[model samples]
Structure formats: C-alpha cells, structure tokens
Target: MEETNLYYKLGGQKAIRAVVEEFYRRMLEDELVNEAFRGIDMDRLRNHQTAFLSYALGGPVEYDGRTLREGHKGLNITSEQYERMIRIMNDTLRTFNVADEDRVKIEAFLRSVKPFVVGQ
Candidate 1:
C-alpha cells in the first residue's frame, strides 16, 4: 500500500497551505462554523489550521500551540459538531483533489482525535 504520508512528501508546504486556506475559507462561510468561531481571531485561527494539518501530515513544522483538548476546553463540542468538522475536513481534501490514500490518512487522524476533541 502506498504510504499516506506520500501526500506530504509530494507537495510539502505548498500542498498543506492550499488545503488549510481552502478549509478555513469554507469554515468562514459555513453558518455552523461561523457561529462557533465567533469572537475567535481569524488570523490566529488561520495559523492554527495550517499548523494542525502540517502536524498531522508529517511535515517538518512543529506545532507548539495549546493541546487540542486544552484549546477546545469548555467549548462543549457535541458529537454533531465533531461530525461536522470531519465532514468539513473531508470536503476540504476533496476540494484540493487529494488522493484516496491521503484522504484515508486524514480520516484516520481525525478519528483518533475525535474523542479528545469532542469529549466523548
């Protein structure tokens, strides 16, 4: 099987940058996410988005920001919220024409983080 990290190996920073920018743009226009992001700094959110993808995709960049749980602490994210985020993530990958293997890796990573993120 082709390694999922191949996506990162293939496109490096440029590919990750594209996916994150598109993802955040979509989030900004999404009513659910827009409301969730209310009062959050868009610029910082943008950076976090990129750092997140980079970290997950095995890029050289190291994300030193708050832990996912800590950052989302007290947000009380529901299962629905977690599903929506996963859907958005999949859509974002599709928008960038990510390959199936890479998409699988993304899905796996999201699944791994779901419980922590949603407090399940």
Candidate 2:
C-alpha cells in the first residue's frame, strides 16, 4: 500500500506556503488574535512559519527557525489564542481542498505541539 504523508498531500513547499499565507491573512484580520502579532515583523514571521510547517508536515525541506519553545518564549500565548490559530489553519486547509483525514492529522500535530507554544 502507498504510504500516506502530509507533506506530499499538501503539495510540498508550495502548498505549505499557500496555507501559511491564508492562515496569516485570516489571523491578521481576526481581532481576537491580531493583538498577539503587534510589532512583529510579518515577513520574517511568515518565512519562519512556512519552513516550520513544511518540516512539521514531513516535507523535503527542514525548518531553520528557532525551537518552538524558544520561539514562543515571552509571547504569553493562551490556550484560546492557540486554538484560534489552529482553527484558522484548519479553515485554510479546507479552502485548499485538503482531505478531511489529512486536515485532522494536521490538527493533531498542532495540538501535540501546543504546550511548547501556549503559556509560560
């Protein structure tokens, strides 16, 4: 049987970038989470996120960014903010026609990493 992998199903780097773009666009427009991004350099953030997601999804490229915990340090992110970001990501995946199973896998991956991102 052919193996299933999120990287391939997500169409590799290109698709990952697309999803990140849409996810950020949604987040930037949402008042609830937008405050977290204040004073952040969006372009740099996007590049780091694209690489991180690509690597997380098991794509060909690796993330050259900071470790998740280090990266999120001092951010003071709450569980609600984390869930909001995940919701935006899921919506982006749906917009890209990602299979439901794959979307679920993506979400599961995010949840697994939540501790590194939320709270002190």
All candidates: CA RMSD (Å):
2.9, 1.9
For residues 1-120, what per-residue lDDT tens digits would candidate 2 score against the true structure?
Answer: 123678887888788888888899999999889998999999999999989887787777756778989988998999999999899989989999999999999999999999999995
Model 1 TM-score is 0.85
Best by TM-score: 2
Residue pairs clashing, model 1:
none
Q: Which candidate is the best by lDDT?
A: 2
User: What global local distance difference test value does model 1 have?
Assistant: 0.76
> All models: lDDT?
0.76, 0.88
Q: After superposing candidate 1, which stretches have Cα over 4 Å from the reference? A: 1-10
